[model samples]
Target chain A: MAIPLIQFINVSKNFGESHVLKGLNLSIYKGEITAVIGKSGTGKSVLLKHIIGLVQQDSGQILIEGQPLSQLSPKKIKLFYQKLSYMFQDNALFDFMNIYDNIALPLVENSRFPKDQVNKKVLKRMDQLGLIDIEKKFPSQLSGGMRKRVALARALVMDPEIVLFDEPTTGLDPIRKKKVHSMIQEYQKKFEFTAVIVSHDIPEIFNVVQRIALLDDGIIKFEGTKKDILDSQSKILNDFIAGKDI
Target chain B: MLNKLIEKFGEKTINLLKSFGRIILFCFSGVTNIFTLPFQFAKIIEHMWFIGTKSIFVIILTGLFTGMVLGLQGYYSLVKVGSEAALGAAVSLTLISELGPVFTAIMVTARAGSSMAAEIGVMRISEQIDALKTMHINPVRFLFSPRIIAAAISFPLLTALFDVVGIFGGFISGSMMLGINKHVYMDTVIQSVKIHDINVGFYKAFAFALVTTTICCYRGYYTHLYSGFGARGVSLSTTNAVVHSCIAIFIFDYIITFFWV
Candidate 1:
């Protein structure tokens, strides 16, 4: 088998008496979409954060392309983060910034791009995401779906090596969710970067993802292709697929 | 019972020491990042606008009224002692050496200090700080250094402005109202004032600015480390920041002034 693009080795995290992640191990390959589907509060988002160094695990380790993230120097870590991007669940857009500046931030902050080029890049991404002429509007002025799209635009504007989406389609309507799923597919096809999406939106996300990892009790209880998950005899996987809690 | 009291006292002392250590460390990190790679000129300018320009009007009003009051009281007392001509010395000395920096700092603590806390507190609660971190931007450099630098720079200037405006206020009340000649009053002020007094006021102002901003920023920046009340947490941080800034201002003022005395 090929070397895994990202690896979690027996990682554990605890908040006081409660353990959020308990010796979880998983591997993600390059150029693939892997959706971590689990019930709310199962440490799915925590695992995604560890990948990008947002949150640290209490034990074990996380490796990105065979380089241990915990061991990287500050300079190297920042340089590493330039190649990785995360789209927050809150859209985390600066409230004071307009949509254009919001989308333009990751580029402008990380690089010394000229004003006109920055504008062009931001406008291009906005157009690709169907966010035309709304540059002057603040995040507060935009609807939830529009805000998420603007946030995603900021994430992709960097053209990173790995893109992590946290609950990408959580609050959107069915049509908006469908539109977002299509956008992800379209962009993933164009960019071909590794994608790890943390979501509880199960069957809805299943069709859009190539692989599925079922997280339960702070561990990856099941990991395989959608067909394998569907054909498996695991009670938890079956309950998850049938929209019932186990 | 006495042992319990002693034990409780020891625990409280350790906790207080830890908090002080934390603030010093936070200040160290913030100051170091401010001088580190790629300083932000634009954000610094914006912060100066917020901390300096927006604060001038209220400082002017307070300075003028305070000077006038000092002038009125001083003129009355001097007239009783048949030393009404000494009114200029009293007003200028008090305004420059003591009240000017102290009042200006208190006003700013109420105005800009609390707002800085609220702004950073909101950013912390909302995860904008995390967003900056993920984008490889240091939150201390990007969010903090500018405001701290702005307050330090603006406080001394505002204290000087307060001194000037207050002298004019005293001039009006002492000369125009109490019938002391403008020329004699001006001469008295020029003669009585020394450069050391003004310098001391500014040094104190600079020190107070650093203290107030550091306390407010540290308190607000670490709101998440406080109890998790979500919106309530940010609000509490803001309130505590303002309160702490005031307390730190007085404590540092005494410490700095004690050295002078």
Candidate 2:
């Protein structure tokens, strides 16, 4: 078997009295979409944050490409970060910056790209994402779906090795949610980047993701392909999938 | 009961010390980043516009009125002592030595400092700062350093402007409104303001700049840890930043004046 692109070894986290994650172990492969599904406030987002170094685990190890994250040298860590992109639940676009500048920030800050080259890259991404005319418009000026597109464009602008999505279809209507999932699928194929999506979209998400992980009570209770999960005889996983209050 | 009181006091003291330690570290990070290479000139210039250029009108208005008041009062007191010719010396000296830097700092605290706190607080609550961090942009360098650089450069300059406008206001009130000869007033003003006095004013302005900007930025940067969340948290952070910065400015003013004197 190939080495997992990312692996969590008995990770744990606590916020004050609440234990958000407890000895949670998981692995993610390169060039595939893995969905982590759990009910609200079950630390699904915290788990995603841990993967991106936004939130630190209390114990255990997170290894990226067979190397433990905490052990990397500063320069190597910078390289690690360069390979990662996170799409926040809020989009987190700089409200003061217009769409073009927003999309160009990572490039402009990370590299000394000439203005024209930066412009070309941003415009190309904008064009591909159907965000051409709205380049000058601020994130606040755009509609929900359009803002989502801008976020995706900015995330993909760096051509990172891994992308983590935190509820990308949140607060959208059904049709828009489907569109967003489809957008994610299309982009993942086009870019061939490894993806870890934290979501609760259930059956709709099952179709989009290759594998599923069910998290409850601070541990991943199930991990397998969608077909495997559907055929498995796990009561807790079944109850969660059926939307029953466990 | 007494032990419980002592314990509670100890806890509070430790918490206060920790808070102070954090503030010092945060300010140190911002100050050190100001010297980091590949300087953030664009953001620094933008902050200078926000902190300095936008503050010109309010500084001028405050300086003029303060000087006018000093002239009116100084003229009356000097006439009683048969030294009304010394009115120019009195107003200019008071302004250059004390009021110019202090009032400019307070006015700036009310204007730009509050805005900095509120803006950063909003960004913190909204996770925009985290977004920057994830983008590999240091939030302290991107947000606070530019503001600190702007404040360090702008405060002394604004204090100088305040002193000049105030001296002019005194001239309007004394030489033009009253019967003091213009040349005598101008001469007394020129003779009274030693370079040391101007230095004292500027030193105070520089100190106030660091104190106010650090406190405001520190308060806003740590808004997530405060007692509230969301809008109320932001409001609390802004309020604490402005109130604490103003208080800190006065405290540092006294310390600097004590040492300089």
Candidate 3:
């Protein structure tokens, strides 16, 4: 039980009359890849958002490393952000910035690192991700897979302790999907950071995440290891495992 | 049929009111967030370059041409009234009271406002805004404030540039093109255009800057209200940003004039 790095305690959220998350309770252990799987609009991404205090739960608590998110002031929240990174579904690189600048933004904004150091660090990360050639290219110029890798590189640039991935393989082809999954695994191993991934692509994610949480109708219907997910007799889990309506 | 129509219209009107209310609330919260956060001088400089330096050429070109046209038109109209010497006064007054602020605002709304909406809209769609929140970064301070502050500072300066260039254009037209005495043209402008006229333009520019930035940021900030993604949504937000900001500028301009006069 290594003091679960993140916890959602009966967290709930509603968008108007429609509830997105319903009394959800889950904990994410450090250095583990936790996959949140559900059909579209089942609040997988919303749950990931709550963990990082992106969206406050309507009536519950979210704790990161034993500290409640709501209690932290805005300044403290910014400090907390330094320890977390997010990989957006669309790889939301500032289109105005070149890839090198995009990856260097957090460092330049938050860290005490000077320009030369930021450049060196960015180039080193880019090299690790095989993105050295596209350093000057904007996000629009990169392929979907390349964009995802660049986003991952940017997320890792700060050496964050937690990384949230929102649909890392949504629009990619099978080859690219595999590549993204492998990248996720590689980064998780190298950084030893808690990785919380939201994706409907269960099969691909199953190969990477240590544990899986199945969300249905705004609730966590089941939570267990990959073996438990594969062996479950629950109908909702069955449909999900069978790749029906995913 | 009348009842049904009233119901439909009532619903739409209420929704519109709600939207307006939300925009005001968002602006207030954004302002508060900016104050709550620690000042980042580097971010301010980055935005000044983006919002001010980048927009200079367009603003200058727009101002120059507007002045020239105003001068030519005013000269002809004053001549028709047998007061051709009043050309400079009319041109200067109109530029300072109206064109300088209004046209500059419209240009900014089209150039920066639309892009602001699109940028934030994309961030909304991509959940980068959420990422910021999760990272404990107030999107307002991180994203919105810089633009608002930049626009606030730039709009008045740009409007002054517009007035200067416009007045010069009028001088050039009255003296060189219309064959009016340079002294007469200069005297009319000096006599009629008081400090208050320039002050009015500056005030309006400030108001327009606030209106345009608020509308654009509000439109983009709450983009989740819109369903769907891709080019259509982005285009819708861009149009909304420009149109709403323009309308807001005009509406505020009227309000300010009502008081300032």
DockQ-based class of model 3 = acceptable
Best by lDDT: 2
- Candidate 3 stretches with Cα past 4 Å from truth are A1-5, A9-12, A16-19, A59-82, A112-117, A170-183, A186-190, A199-204, A227-239, A244-246, B1-81, B168-178, B226-230
- Please write out the lDDT profile of model 3 over residues B1-261, one tens digit for every residue: 999999999999999999989988877876676665357666668877777778889987877788788878888888888999888898889989888899989987888888889888888887777656544456777788777777888889888888888888888778888899999988998999999988999999988988899889888877768535666777788788888888888899899999996
TM-score (C-alpha) between model 2 and the true structure: 0.96
- The sequence of per-residue lDDT tens digits that candidate 2 reaches over residues B126-189 is 7788888777888898889989999999999999999999999998899899889999999998
Model 1 chain B is weakest, by summed lDDT over 10 consecutive residues, at B222-231
Model 1, TM vs. native? 0.94
lDDT of each: 0.87, 0.89, 0.82
Q: What is the fnat of model 3 with respect to the true interface contacts?
A: 0.55
Model 3: DockQ against the native?
0.44
Listed in order, the DockQ scores are 0.74, 0.69, 0.44
Q: Model 2, which residues run further than 4 Å from truth?
A: none
Highest-TM-score candidate:
2
Docking class of 2: medium
